[model samples]
Target: MVEVRMRVNGAVRSLEVEPRVSLLDALRDHLGLTGTKKGCNQGACGACTVLVDGERINSCLALAVQYAGREVVTIEGVAADGQAHPLQEAFIRNDGFQCGYCTSGQICSAIGMLAEHRAGVPSAVTEHLAADVELSAAEIRERMSGNLCRCGAYNGIVESIQDVAS
Candidate 1:
């Protein structure tokens, strides 16, 4: 077992886990943070997405020990003082979910994606990689391509992110 220590949901969390334990399992089975779902245990689905040091990643693909000193932000960590993040509010207002199984991952991914865009990181669909990328429909789609909504709520998800970005 490996000893892992990280800040999760604004609290310092320290635990012993198998070296091979995935971050998703550590969070859900160990820490009781079940909001981050397990969809495709593989990286193909975004259901296990979470933020490590403010960047979104597929928790299923990450080892808990690998994130020992990082700040891990799950869906439960997005709110502050019992108030939802603006993106969370926008998702609700835009009806961005159906079954909601993918909502947590989508929201976490959107939060990181917005941060990347704001930092001038270009997406594959950005016409001019050297130019500032605007948060257009195409841009949003490209940025969120990694997240899949089995409920086919792409339109609403995109709208929600766009709303929050604007």
Candidate 2:
């Protein structure tokens, strides 16, 4: 087993894992951060989404060793001072979740999507190539396409993101 150290949430955490151990396993199994769920165990589902250096990625597809010394943020880290992050609040306020299985990934992906929008990253529906990217409903939908909600709470999910984006 190789030793990997990563800044999870806010503190540095060290654990031993095989080179092939997924970041999802390392977080949920090794570190006890179960908020990052394991769904599909493949890249197809965004249920294991998390942030690496402030960018969202599918944790199930990322090896733990590759993230050594990097900053990894899970759903547990999204809030500050024990208060729910604005997105989390918005999620509750907007009924963005159901079944609660995909909520964490949805929230994390939404946060990353917001960051991308603020940086003027364009999505598939973004029409104006030379202009500032607007966070239209279509753009939000396109950008968050990776995360699938089995409960079909997509309308609320989109609304939650829109609430925060605006």
lDDT of each: 0.92, 0.90
* Model 2 residue 124 lDDT score: 81
Number of colliding residue pairs in each model: 0, 0
Error of 1 at 131 (Å): 9.4
lDDT of 2 at 106: 90
lDDT of 1: 0.92
Model 2 collision count: 0
How well does model 2 score by local distance difference test?
0.90
The segments of candidate 1 whose C-alpha lies over 4 angstroms from its true place after superposition are 128-133
Clashes of 1: 0
Estimated TM-score for each candidate: 0.96, 0.96
Candidate 1, residue 39: how far the Cα is off, in Å: 0.5
**Which candidate tops lDDT?**
1
RMSD of each: 1.5, 1.5
